[model samples]
Target: MDIFDTLDDTAIEEEALMYDYLNQSARKEKIVRPRVDHFKEWDSAEFHRRLRLITESVEYLLFLVKDETETKTQRNQYISPMLQLLITLRFSATGKFLCLYL
Candidate 1:
């Protein structure tokens, strides 16, 4: 088998493990956060603020990973944008993101 096949096998195993963990965790009692009354309204300012925070956090994480990789490689290459696009396309087609660890 080639490297891609090996990687694909590893990803499938990892996802199965993750699914098992999530299923187990779901069985436990969990506290749910209360939703606000305006949650369903698109014009709610609170919802906009929450959305902005989520976007910023995702952006920050992508930046942090790129920064760390650049520090080690010194080649100034990053995979996040391409990865994100691939993920989006995969989800659009398959209804799930493909597990790509690298």
Candidate 2:
């Protein structure tokens, strides 16, 4: 008769676990993911093939947006402008959001 009656036990348990995780007292520390230097890793041909732009062109775009994209505060080391630009271009070129994380 009620909404609780519709959700199975597994669903109810999962919801409870998610609620607990969201309300945990101790904040989890930020994860420091290892960064790959794409500029160094990919050759000019490979970079163009993947991202649809040569490294030099990417650099030029980065130079334009570097001032705006840069994090003003030093509290956390944010993703670099170059990396942001690369991720965006990769998404634009391939239309795959998962590629950004990989």
**For this target, which candidate reaches the highest TM-score against the unseen true structure?**
2
TM-score of each: 0.21, 0.61
Candidate 1 per-residue lDDT, tens place, 3-91, comes to 66667777988989999999998896856554333324434444334343333444465565654433344233333442453344446
Clashing pairs for predicted structure model 2, backbone only: none
Off by over 4 Å in 1: 1-53, 68-82, 85-95, 98-102
Candidate number achieving the greatest lDDT relative to the actual structure: 2
Residue 28 shift from truth in candidate 1, angstroms: 57
- Number of clashing pairs per prediction, in order: 0, 0
